[model samples]
Target: MSTSSFALRLMDVHVSLAGHEVLHGIDLSLTAGRWSSIVGPNGAGKSTLLKAMAGLLPVTGSIFLFDQTLMAMDRKQRAQQLSWLGQNESASDDLRVWDVVMLGRMPHQDWLAAPSAKDHAVVETALQATGAWDWRERSLGQLSGGECQRVLLARAMAVQAQVMLMDEPLANLDPPHQVDWLEQVRCLTSQNTTVVSVLHEVGMALHADDLVVMQAGRVVHQGPCADAVTHRAVEAVFGKRIAIHALDGQWVAVPKF
Candidate 1:
């Protein structure tokens, strides 16, 4: 296979937590500028896989980012190229939303340095992109669950990184807001930003360019999002309890019963 198009490649990657293995050896390659969605049942290690890719978890195998080993890159350099939005990210509730979003620029700033004009502009764009601009001056504690999720998304977007990893980004979002977030991700990918997301919503995962289906800590399926074989694998992993269907040109996973 031609590796030239891949941004990240994993070779025999394995991860363990609390002395119990979560991810079995996972070998995969993710293409640059493409959107990938990972789906699996509960405790299927979907989140673990994303964390490993983000270099947030301890793994024994090699993960090469943009042709460079993740281990070889310094922490700061890694931050310059990758951004992560974890599930239920904690924030200082008393902090203003703008200040919270500005935290994303820390990697680009010098010690004790003030926010630059560029930093402010980037934060503004990020906030607007996530529809969080109106709450810029509000306290984080004042926002609802869904609003907080958008603000956290804004912080991730402000990183200006080439690659982004997100876990359950739509957790607190309503249907309409979820659609908006999808559009935001589409726009980012158009700008050549690689996005890898872990989603429990199978229908939402279908919107990605590619799909990775996991079961028991291993990827059982990976291919074009609309591929029939991939859809079959998705059903098989769930013991055929959910049926994949096509409705109005969209794929949806509905319960078999």
Candidate 2:
């Protein structure tokens, strides 16, 4: 298939942090309108991979967004195509939830452009989608970690980007919120948005449309999420402490003992 057909494509991608290599020579092509999960142990470069894909980390590889080379696109153009939720994102504590959500509209606006009716509608819809509508008037400092995370997710959704890249998005979420998070991802895919996320929850990651198993700075496997071969790859990448099982028509990884 042509590279342009892939929603997000990478060629020989490499990333380093604090003078140490985190990702090495990774090549991946995420299909359009699919939900993909990046799973790995601590320091395995799952987050690094996502950051590289979002153009957050300076890396030494070719990244293409549909038919355009990522680096060639201007900042505004790239921001319009890719929306990102970074790990442990923190905003101004003084801003209200609604104000924070409005930040997502910046990419679509000119300098000093005021929020339009369309922007307000999009923000409202995103807040409802993330269950943060009720907290729209609340100050960011007053919210619990989970609530703030939801608000941030709503902001990302408000960007209305074709590709969403999230790093450890479920970090502050509860069990119910985690389930809702997965459903939000599915909903994005259904709307033809592509998503890639770094997740610590193996079981949740297994539910994605495709899986990328990373280990020691390399992509050990990438394929259909339900394939037995991919299951084996997950087991191998994570070691025997994790076991893969089918539950409710979805694959999950759990402890063996």
Candidate 3:
């Protein structure tokens, strides 16, 4: 694929935590305007890879956001180009929902500057999109686990970045809210945004446009989600304990007997 077609690229990427190398050499290219899910069994380093792509952790290889070297970009520039939603993120309990979402605008604002009108508009739209508008005045600590996740998602959406990296975004979300989250992701891709998520729910991960299957800290398969090969790879990584099936025109993973 042409470099221009990629939203993010990595070459020979390696990560280490606490004197232990977590990710091996990884080469990945994520197409722009597409949603890709990374899945693996426990200790497969899915989150570590995502963190590397986000530039949150030190990496030994090259990572580029579009054409720019990720580590070379200034903090503000990186923040404006890539938005991140972490798993089980903690926010101050006293922070109002609206204020928390507004924080997403920090990259676009001047130091100590008040929010511009456009920032307010974006935050409001994000909150409404996540169904958290009614809680705009409520504090973050007052919300349930699922509710907090929605708010954090809104905050990430409020950034309106070109690429979004989400780790376990569906955590704490019930089935209905999970469906809502899928819709929200679809809306993002419709606008040509690139979304990469690490999900533990195999069924939910299959909903993505493509799947990045990993095992033992290396990418074992990268292909369209509907492909039989991808399904086999997914099932393989999980020790064939799950089976992939097509149900009502959508793919789902079911437990193996």
Q: lDDT tens digits, residues 163-231, model 1?
A: 999999999999999999999999999999999999989889999999999999999889998899999
Which one wins on TM-score? Answer: 3
Q: Give residue 198's lDDT in candidate 1 (0 to 100).
A: 95
lDDT leaderboard ranking: 3, 1, 2
Per-model RMSD to reference: 0.9, 1.0, 0.6
> What would you estimate as the lDDT of candidate 3?
0.96
Cα lDDT, all candidates: 0.93, 0.91, 0.96
- lDDT (Cα, 0-100) at 22 in candidate 3: 89
Which residue segments of model 2 deviate by more than 4 Å? none
Candidate 2 TM-score, true structure as reference: 0.97
- What TM-score would every model get versus the actual structure? 0.98, 0.97, 0.99
Cα lDDT for residue 230, model 2?
A: 89
Error of 1 at 109 (Å): 1.2
Candidate 1 lDDT for residue 32: 95
Predict model 1's lDDT versus the native.
Answer: 0.93
Task: Tell me which residue pairs clash in candidate 3.
Answer: none
Alpha carbon deviation, residue 75, candidate 2 (Å): 0.3
lDDT of 2 by residue, 194-255 (tens): 99999888888888999999999999999888899989998887777888998887777889
Residue runs of model 1 more than 4 Å from their true location after superposition: none
